[model samples]
Target: MLIARWIFDIDTIDGRSAADVQGAAPAVVLDESVRVVPGRDGEALAFDGRAQAVIPAAPQLVLSQVFGFALAFFVNVTAPPDGEWRGLLYKPVGENDARGVGMWLYPDAMRVRGQVFTAKGPDYVDSRTSLRVGEWTHVAFVADADGMYLYIDGRLDVGVPLEHEVVPPYGPIYLGGQPDRPGFTGLLDDLRVYASALDAGTVQALARPPS
Candidate 1:
């Protein structure tokens, strides 16, 4: 059975708010909530490239040992300016410090990127391939003792060390975008966060279209 710390699926979709399907954590749609659109599978939550969904900092997300974690989601690129970096998900730590780990799109590189932020420093990795615009693609960001891994369409795109252990960000997770970066303008579906790094096979299985 597929398991995850948090799963946000079609049942969680809302016009102005979203609730985790397997937990109590809820995310508030900010700045004029995005629209709901037919997803590559069942249903998806859409972002306007300017709006976001915020999940407050709580026990469900705040962990002391984030040694290994992976975030997976499906997206359809739509209207990001060429060469711009767009945020997919992030967690803010503080003002002086960069926000916590996040997933973003590097349009120029035509690939997805993963970033981790903590008091010690930050770590990042870029996916090897570009996202086919206007098409649904599955992406994941993973971090463990070995390193940070970026998966695109269920394939390992990048794998690099995540440096040493560092304090995790103590804050909420932002979906679609962050304050400093522009959010993705398109469809987002089947968002999930796992406590442990998922292997390539599991990730590939996740990429399978929902039934």
Candidate 2:
């Protein structure tokens, strides 16, 4: 499998802090509040209010790591399913595997409710945290070689194997809800995707705000 490099820096929108960064490979600027700016050390992108953006993956890019947060609402993706779960919001996969996509939430108690269907079967994963609202948190999913690892606020929350081989005509990754479905109702910031598996430390580093 060939891995491609892509970067998205949110610093061009209005009301956003000016940080020098490499923006998204294929990104969308929703409202006028968000902007890409130069960060003290790196590039910084800021979000002021509700906005939506999508980054197109390389044709052969296999999603392995996703890092970002839904400032107020939630971001979503379209993982085109092959068999039973036909047209649902799923994670992306390579040509060989057919297991569904994986996602992780942060701040401990944030609610993540969605429908996941697979050839093997379908299931649900909920939130578990004790933090108050408005607290900044981080979440990551390492879906590939090993399996699925869900990280909440930089810590491991759940890890499971590929319940089923997630084959595709995989759909595009949607931000803020499944395309054509009910849209997400919140703010998303610092979103990123990688073609390789990111270890715990790497995931943590990506989650941290630019210093």
Candidate 3:
């Protein structure tokens, strides 16, 4: 059984929000199963959990100064047509703007995909690789001023070079499903986000179960 060392204790220095910030000591108590761990070598947040649920206020509530995010989850499929497993990183956009990037796992493959629409319309792109079913796979994205790289189990599968310079604003970042399209389903565990690029050593540390 997995135990949460620190669920929603705001008194600790690593607490999730201002209400829960270290010293404020809010009375928040997360569901018994969810745990947040400090990232290995950087100032990042990571979560470990057992079910498919959303951290609704993830962006504004939890993340600050985050430039890159990654999610690793288990795909439990007892039968055919296994559900669509996707992880998204989103920040607020103006009503007229349509641009962001996400990584997804379809039944056949996994993809590094994104969309951009200034005022003309929406443009989209994707790079996919075949993936195994009903297994726990590590999917990660590292984004900076240069562009984004999609990784599977710590190895680069596809690189989406930016046509123009791209930078992630310090707004709320989301995971698990598209903000616009909710209810796409899967089991996500060990989700993480960082303010800086996670190096190989850090990624390996994150991949390991907490001690």
Candidate 4:
């Protein structure tokens, strides 16, 4: 089940709260840098490559201490200009590590990175797929006992197995951008996070625009 879904359809902003259409959690608009822009479905949050909105790691937003998790969103990239990694959705993987187990955009590919503490084994895994610019694209990432998967526009493009034990992350989830990386220079809409890994069919269905 999805603990929260931020559709960003409403323009109402009471203080720092950004309502979650799924009726679970509200993201605190950090620094008031993000704005609500008319998006693919209705409305979306726009980050100016500076600020980010964050949903705190409340009990409801935290996933179970398991490897199963999934995230999906609709994005339209207007300009990436630089090759700097831009975060789409992220959760701090470790306190010491600068990177996280989350989705990031490269110059041409979108990557999902994750790692587990280990002296040996498949502790680090990543999935990547090329991305198209100037249009709305549906992206999805799933990590579970089966491994990590990345989907673009609902199409399964990358999948890898988790060969070692990995602890789940309980840190706050950031959308639009991460702490160290640049915010997305575009619009984001219909963001969702599920506690369980979704199958290919389910992910494809989710990619369909609201009708």
Candidate 5:
């Protein structure tokens, strides 16, 4: 089931808040640097490597058995020389423990990567190939009892075995940036969170352009 969705179709983050289409609490914008601009569908939220939005923690946001998320993103420019990592989506468990699921862009490589942390260890997967700059791409990351899967443009890119089941990260969802990590320097739209992992057919349907 779709738990949380942020379409970012509004012209502005009115009152510093963006509506969650699924009826969740509005996401609070972090700063003024974030802007609403043209997106693959309607409008997208732009992050200039400094701003972000936070969705308060809710019981439904926590997933243990199966879950996944998909988003449309367009990288505006390459990362600065000093940029090491920039977060696209992050939900952490603790400040010191490796217990979270996150997807980020390796700006320098222009590649997308996803990771999941469990009691056993962390599993990682990446697109292996670079994405074209200035173009919107649909990316999805799914975690199930079998393993973790990374899909780009609705196609399976890679999968990594989950040594241990995912430990639900109980925390607020951070979009486009994190408090400690570099913010994503790009446009993000159609962010969706699901309680169940999406299958290949459904993922393909999501990647299709809106009519």
Candidate 6:
């Protein structure tokens, strides 16, 4: 089931925050540079690697065994410098780890990565193909009883075996950026979080452009 979604269609409460279309919680903008721009859907939020937002911790926002998230992104320019990992969505458990699940763009390797951090350590899968700069692309991360999967443009890019059940971190959800790391340099739209793992059909539906 869909637990939370953000379209950034409009700004409210004096433009200091963006409401989650699902009514879960508001994403409070941390920097004034975060702007509402035309998006893949109705409207999108633009992050300049310094703009970010925070959604307070909530029980319904955490995902465990079977869960998934999808979002549309458009890079503003060429990928970041090699070896630079830019944050997309992050929930840091402690100061050093993204304890629950995190999504990032690793332009250094020209790939995207999805991670699930268990008690033992973090396990991740990288997309087999490189990301296209300045193009809107749909990306998702899903985990089920079998393992974790990463999707690009509604297709399964790769999957990794699960060694342990996910251990969700007790932390606020960070959008666009996380602490001590650079933010995403692009436009983001239609971010959705689900309580259950999504199938290929559902992912494809999410990836499809409005006709």
77-193 in candidate 1: lDDT tens per residue? 887456677888887664335667878877565577787764467777877788877898989887776677888888898898755674566677888877757788888877787
Tens-digit lDDT string for candidate 6 (147-175)? 88888888889998887867766577777
Position 55, candidate 2: lDDT: 36
TM-score against native, each model: 0.86, 0.55, 0.52, 0.84, 0.88, 0.88
lDDT of 5 by residue, 1-211 (tens): 7877778787435667777777864465546777887777788888888788787777777867554433333344334424477788887875444538888878577777888777777778887756666777788888888788877887888887776777777777787768767866777788888888888898888888789
What residue runs in model 2 are displaced by over 4 Å at the alpha carbon?
1-24, 29-52, 64-109, 113-125, 130-132
Question: Across residues 68-170, which tens digit of lDDT does each residue of candidate 3 receive?
Answer: 4333332322122334444434433332233433444444344435443223343344556544444445565555444456566666666654455443332
Tell me which of candidates 1 and 3 scores higher on lDDT. 1
Question: Model 4: per-residue lDDT, tens digit, 1-211?
Answer: 7877877766645566677766667565655788887888777788787768887766666553264778888888767447677767776644434334566676445444444332233355455555566688888877777567778888887776766655555577777667666866888888888888888999999988778
Clashing pairs in 4: none
Among all windows of ten consecutive residues in candidate 3, which has the lowest summed lDDT? 1-10
TM-score of 3: 0.52
Clashing pairs in 6: none
Scored by lDDT, model 1 comes in at: 0.72
Range of the 10 consecutive residues with the lowest summed lDDT in candidate 5: 69-78
**Candidate achieving higher TM-score, 1 or 3:** 1
Provide the lowest-lDDT 10-residue window in model 4.
Answer: 113-122
How many angstroms is residue 121 displaced in model 1 relative to the true structure, after the best TM-score fit?
1.3
| CA lDDT of each prediction against the hidden true structure | 0.72, 0.38, 0.39, 0.69, 0.72, 0.72
Against the correct fold, how does model 6 do in TM-score? 0.88
Separately for all candidates shown, the number of backbone clashes (residues 3 or more apart, or on different chains) is 1, 41, 1, 0, 0, 0
Better of 1 and 2 by lDDT: 1
